[model samples]
Target chain A: MVNSFDVARLAGVSQSTVSRALRGDSKVSERTRTLVADAAKTLGYVPNLAGRALSSGRTNRIGLLVTDLSNEFYHRLIGPVVDRVDEHQHEVVLLADNQSTSDIPNRIISLGLDGVILATTTTDSVIPYKLREKNIPFVYFNRIAPAVPADAAVIDLTDGMQDLVNAIKRNGYKRVGAILGPKNATTGTLRANIFFELLAQNEIFVPFDYRVNGDFSIPAGLEGFQELMSREVPPDVIFCANDVVAMGAINAAHVYDIKVPEDVALVGFDDLPEAKWPIFSLSTVGFDLEKLAAVAVDLLFERIENPEADFKTVELPSYYVTRKSLP
Target chain B: MVNSFDVARLAGVSQSTVSRALRGDSKVSERTRTLVADAAKTLGYVPNLAGRALSSGRTNRIGLLVTDLSNEFYHRLIGPVVDRVDEHQHEVVLLADNQSTSDIPNRIISLGLDGVILATTTTDSVIPYKLREKNIPFVYFNRIAPAVPADAAVIDLTDGMQDLVNAIKRNGYKRVGAILGPKNATTGTLRANIFFELLAQNEIFVPFDYRVNGDFSIPAGLEGFQELMSREVPPDVIFCANDVVAMGAINAAHVYDIKVPEDVALVGFDDLPEAKWPIFSLSTVGFDLEKLAAVAVDLLFERIENPEADFKTVELPSYYVTRKSLP
Candidate 1:
């Protein structure tokens, strides 16, 4: 309940002096700063956060806009972002970007956010355009808008795809089917292209009907799995776009009374935490998303500090995790 | 980025008038209010959040301090809390309260949080003591301190447990082992007592060796399941401390190649979203956690508005959810 004014009054110092001392401004002598600090500490006096915020014109706060707050993937992403933001003495305000119809940029500006981190922007997203027009400093998270070039932290799925193909070929699997994400998604496009390209190099051809489409949801994966099962002859192995999709496929397999690795092999992308659970233990390719998030946070800070800095895209390497879900 | 000063300058009014007009505060003259508002909209001017925060001495922001940000249960609770907070033109600051042994309250104050919703407090938690001493407004979310008796939203599992007992009896599953959380926890003690009392009513008992204790985590559930399995004859059914613990038990069953319901029945508490997933359709106690969260958010605001308001406790009813996991 105690404010800086109370500390100033107790220390017999002016309010401005208290502010200067607290901020460690060079105008205030070291002795005065120490005295003010001691009194502040003794009284448990904290600066009026509201007043300090007004003076600096910065709340020392950043906006973290995520599309899906409930997604397991997003939850994993939040951990690293929080750590990185906290390290910079900045607090992140979560903005659940519900739909395209939401007035996100305006809300972010109204909140007086120092900067915005677009962790959930899509390729066709108008969020970046609006933010850029407003001159509101923003850094893209995992996904990116090619038309609006900004700093981003992305995974290059190239290496992982190569390994995925090599593994499949060595395991003597030819009939392969893929449960991919939405066609419009950059992650989907990149992942699928890279996967097929690597497969072509290994002389592994995928049938057109073997591909199933999903929207990166568990239900989507389940539907895709059913599509594969309904085939005249189900593929020997099924590759999912992401772990969420894979889990859904496995769940569908259970419902269909199909055994994993015995009847068919399952592989997933994004080695999420649940992938290693004793229940699933799914085999998949994974990168350190936590590190990627930290880098994204740091990138945003860097971009905010140096707006003219060249846009740099950091690509993290991925590796396959061997588990019971795959042979 | 334009502030009240810009709008006031354009509208030929004082900054105070601009603030009153923008906020729709009644003291401002209607003509002046309209002119100020028009200028604000035309110029796309947004109020300096810090300046408004300074004058009001309040930020419409509440903190939800929780442990384990990656948990699915938290995800389910967050949506309702966010909805209620947004209705008050307020935001919930997500704080990961993972450091269980740290000075929780001091850290909260340091963060300059307006108020906190304690979602993971134990009965003997020092956080309540510190907040009470500081006269900081906080409400218990899904957890309560009976000693302090502040505003709380707790789930009464009596009905759920009663139904569970009856179901167990009717199904002819007599031996019931428990995977309980920490002994000092309010939920731990409360649920344990209720379970024992309800079992006594049905004349079904659990021997001392049939119990396994740990934190409310998946590993704890696995360990408890293993411990129970080591007995001369494992219990026919296991009642977990919560949904997550139940999942751990289920995973353990899978690991040991035991079937659910047929070989052993597993029942969880707090029917999380994952509980309904086809992979793990865990039957557990169901309650309106979304509504519970909204109540907790509303309680914090109520306390903020009227600190002298009678400290109240809210208990919500829980019911049994029969699924494939249980007979």
Candidate 2:
């Protein structure tokens, strides 16, 4: 609870002098600045964020909004974003959305967030529209909302999917089973479409019974893999939406003593750090996710500082990471 | 920007009437409440947290201060703590002290945090001292500061360690090596001390060269295990501070083509959900981590509501989960 008054009292100066000294105002003498700082430190004084923010009308705090906080792929995105934001002396607040759709938009603004990076935007999401209508500066991470133009950092999956098709053709795999993410998600739908077209080009098509719908969760992957495994005829290879899902599916297959890339092959997306583990050498689509996250944070800052700036879309290219899980 | 005035205009009532109706005050007629609710929905009127907090002198927000958010263990802990906090309609602000400490008590208070849960408090943290001096309500989640007395939810590692030791002895493990966490951390120091005492009671003497220091990180575990393996005569069994660390060590071993259990048996602590994965089958300690996290959140809220309540230390018991890695 120590304040400027206490610092001033110890420094033999007025409270105004203490404030100026702390704020690095030119009016405060060099000798007085040292005296005030030492006193403040001794008294364990911390600057009140609200007081400073209210007076200056500036909160150097940005919110990083993500749907899933515990996901390994998502968690890896936080470090680079936070580090980059901190370099500019701004704070990053992690706002995990567990709210209903109706509550999200208002809640974001009600918190008086200076800006936000939408790390999990969907094509049909109203968040972009609401933020735009409210004139709130935001940038999308790993997702591009085509409907509402905004600065975005996205991963281009076309090249990787083409390579995956090539691999499937080389292996002579005709029956492929897939665990796709929610159909509503831009990523899931886009990947599925691209993958289908590539498969067509390779003269292969999976039956409707071979595909299972799920959200991006381990349990969903396990359930989806189980459904596919118990089919009239199991698939030659199983493709998962991401490495985490693939890990779960592989584990589930292990429960049945199914050898990876022998009994069945597996391919995933988002080459997470865990994918390289010795126990599970999962092949996946790769991109610089951390750098992509940093780009999103940078984009948000740019939009906040220069709202009139041209909206830019950064499409990071992805490639296949060949490993033991996929032939 | 639909304020009370707009709601009042739409409801055909005074601004005060609209406010009363919104709060469901009995002074307002039931007919007026319906009108006000309908107007609020139409105008998208959400209550201002600042105005409410100003009048009530409280903000329904708490801080969860963690040293490492990217760690899988803490990531898992977040889900349960957040679920509990969400049920109480409280917002969580993340505070991280990644490598060094900050003035936590003053910072939390300035941010208007009602309480805080510390997930990674070192033994001699200044945070506990400052919080005690400020009379701020706080709770420890799997961690406690020695200087401050407070409600804490922690795991008792005695049972699990004992079970693991019995398994090792029964299997004729003559020599043991341990990768302990930082010397300053209470959990690390406590586990190491208890483990050594039990080993000695079992008439097993651990060689000085078998011990390695770490910071509870994968890299630390990897390097520490390498350091141990470099010894002329390595131990027969290796015990890591936690599952993540054990995984790192196991991976390091895998790189050298060292077969686990046959080459060197491994054990771990805090058997994470992934330990039971067929790929890992990591023998380690087991406790209800979700329940432990929920208990910590509950303790924080209890401290906030009843500041004068008796300080209690709740220790959750752990047991051994025998898996392939240890056998």
Candidate 3:
């Protein structure tokens, strides 16, 4: 039951000084901070974050809002985001936007998070607007709500898609099929649009029946691939929205006894770690995952520090990685 | 700017009643709760958890302490844990026990978490002791610190190990090798001990040089497999610490142009989702992951509600899953 008062008495400092030292206030000298830390440790005086948060209106906790926790794509981002947030002496709480949960914005507000990194915002998501209304700072991680002007770290799929399309043309892929991600997600919509535009420009048009739109998930890819393959004349090549989806497509190929590349070439975006596995050897668009995560966290911290600061969108470049999946 | 008072006024209730209704206190009438909720929604009043936490001595925030967020094994557990915690109307904050940062216990206290699900406790870890001293409620998720008696949801490896060893013996494997997990970790040490004992009972002994102890990670599996393979006499069958490590071993096999089961049979514990991938078809020890996560959360909540309750250890059963990895 030792309190800050006990630590202050032991450290021969005032209660306010003890608080300042423990909070790592720059005004407190390093020597004083060390002394206060030692005294606090000796007394087992854990600082009351609730009381401090009440006073300073800062919780030092950020909410990482993700749509699907089961997806491997978000799994890759969590570690990097947590590490970067830790550098700022902040904690990351997972805020799942479960489709069944309708009160996420209220929950986020109730938690009193210092900021949030929105990794699952769809193009028309209402969460961003709700956050803005409440003055809760948030940065879009991989997707953005176009209606809301906010800081975001996104991938530039233009060059990567162009390169992939060119490669497909060079390989003489007669019929192209695609397993697209959710149309509502900018990550899915933007990538699909740019890819189709590039393909059309390259004189290789994908038929309407050749494309399937689903969420960025393995099941989506598996079902989409199955649907496309059921066609009387299936496409010679299938472009998956992301690596997770490509893995699903690969799984579907296994289920259907179809050999990849020889039967139907497959390409995926976001060169996830599994894409490099010898079994997959998947051709994908690669980007610096760590940088993307760092950027998202940095943008969130910036928004937290300066709510009035003009929002900015930073786009990281992506490059195509040719692997055994491509013919 | 909207607060509880405004909602209370609008809902025709006292401020305390509004608070009780919003908090879902059982004493509050159902009609009053609905009225308060509607009023709060109309006014856009989000309850301040910090203020409520200070008065109630509860934050409704639980910490999920994990060692490695990058590993896929933990990935499978995260979603289930989050969902189960959500059912209790509690939020899950991820607390990474980074090796370099030694003030984790203090961080946990500072966060004022209601309870913690320790998913990464080593046998000799000081975290459990610190948590115990502070009277912080915690439940061991998968690993336990034997020194500290607390509620734990762990896997019983006896049946699985016995079955796996019987299979190995039936296959007529003369040589056996293992990539063991860290000796300090109960998950590693316990699994290794049980496997070895069962192997010895079946009259199969693993040579000293045939074992390499490392963390339960892919790199550990990969390096261990490589090291064992480089030996003049490699074991015909290699057992990995866990599925992630087994994947690393598989990767190494590919790197060395060694066909699995043909060149060297392999086995792994923890039948992760990726184990079912056609590329892996990893033979592993399987358990009810969702049940384990739910049980861990339930134990922590029980400890939180009744701190004086007798500590209980719930051991879930594990079973062997045979796949293409085994000869």
In terms of lDDT, the best-performing candidate is: 3
Residues B1-327, candidate 2, lDDT per residue (tens digit)? 689899999889999888667644678888989999899889998766545445545565777887776676676676667667766656676666672333445566666577888887477677877777767788988877766889999988889889988998999999899998988888888888888988999999788889998988777768888888888988889989888888888878877887788888888888887787776789998799878988888888888879999998899999999999997
Better of 1 and 3 by TM-score: 3
Ranking by lDDT: 3, 1, 2
Cα lDDT tens digits, model 2, A1-327, are: 577788889999998788768756677889989998899889978666555555555555687887776666666676667667765545666666654422677776665667889887356778889889878889988877888899998888888888888888888888999999888888787888888888977778878899998877777778988999999899989989888889889888878888888988999988887888866788888888777877788888788878999999888899988888886
TM-score of each: 0.90, 0.84, 0.93
Q: Scoring model 2 with DockQ, what do you get?
A: 0.38
| Winner on lDDT (1 vs 3) | 3
RMSD of 1: 3.6
Model 3 regions lying over 4 Å from their true place: A5-14, A25-45, A99-102, B6-14, B27-45, B99-102, B231-233
**Once model 2 is optimally superposed onto the true structure by TM-score, how far is the C-alpha of residue B1 displaced, in angstroms?**
3.6
TM-score of 2: 0.84
Alpha-carbon runs more than 4 Å astray in model 1: A1-40, A99-102, B1-43, B99-103
Best by DockQ: 3
Q: What is the alpha-carbon lDDT for the whole of candidate 1?
A: 0.80
TM-score of chain A of each: 0.89, 0.84, 0.92
Off by over 4 Å in 2: A1-45, A56-60, A88-93, A98-102, A121-124, A162-176, A204-207, A229-234, A308-310, B4-43, B53-59, B99-112, B133-136, B170-172, B225-234, B306-310
